[model samples]
Target: MHYFSQSFNYDHSWARVVIGMWHKYPNPHCSHVVTVDVVDRTVDPRTGIIRTERILGCKQRAPIWIVKLFGGSEDAFVREISFVDPSTQTTTISSVNLSLSQFATCNEMIRYSPAPGGRTAFHQTAEIETRMNMWRSAADKLENWLALRFEQNAQLGKVGFTDVLRQLWEDAKDKPAHVSA
Candidate 1:
């Protein structure tokens, strides 16, 4: 198993940052994230909290060795679930790779919260583990590759979301008072 974690601040308010999260895709920085579909969603009226489940489709070329060894393709899918609590000014997202799950799994969690100076704090962590009992060497290689890919994607996600937020709020003279998750 391999672990990764990172934290940073976005130059946007918590609400605006959270709202921009929904529009981070189709970005040049993270072109691998090609499609996003909301599979489920719910809103708690009493608490004013929102929960959403989505499936993300990604297309990226894998290493030739990995493709040959694992018989994998360029297409992959991820299942993501997110919760937004307006009352607390917090948003949390968790995702797991749906493809190649029998061999390995990549679990990622991200959080956005209010920070000082009206910025939003972004924190992310991930765990990559191989489930295969045998072929220890192959499993290790797979885990390492997945970890590297995840780190790259994470960086791109940060840049992509930052751009989205800037485009959505920075240029606008009037920002929306409230944005639903």
Candidate 2:
């Protein structure tokens, strides 16, 4: 198993960050994500917390050898579950690939919380497990390559998320505020 962790700060409130995360799939930086569908969404009556499940279809670029091995295609489906606690200003998300489990599974978790300056501090952790039925030496090489690729992808995701946050801020700024009764 390969593990990865990263943290970054967004110059927006936790609420906006959460909103951005929901709308992040269609952005230019994430063109690989072709479709997003909400499988479930509900609010807990007792705790007032919201929970959601979503599925994403992604088309990813693969190495030449992998493309050849997979017959020239690298499409994957991912499922995500998230919990939102507005009272605590926190949201946590966990995601994993739904397909190709035998070859590999990438499990990811992300947490968002309010920061000192009205920003949001985001923390992410991931584990990539190789489950391929291959020779030991080849499996080791594949795992190492996947680890390096995941690191690069994580950085790109941060930049994409930042862009999403900026768009959310602008959208919120243009909205009219509601007055309490």
What's the residue-level lDDT of 136 in candidate 1?
88
Question: Against the true structure, what is each candidate's TM-score?
Answer: 0.94, 0.86
Ten contiguous residues with the weakest lDDT in model 2 = 172-181
Hey, what RMSD does candidate 2 come out at? 3.4
Alpha-carbon runs more than 4 Å astray in model 2: 68-72, 171-181
lDDT of 1 by residue, 81-164 (tens): 999999999899999999999899999999999999989999999999999574988988999999999999988888888888
Error of 1 at 149 (Å): 0.7
Please give the distance, in angstroms, between residue 38's alpha carbon in candidate 1 and its true position after superposition.
0.2
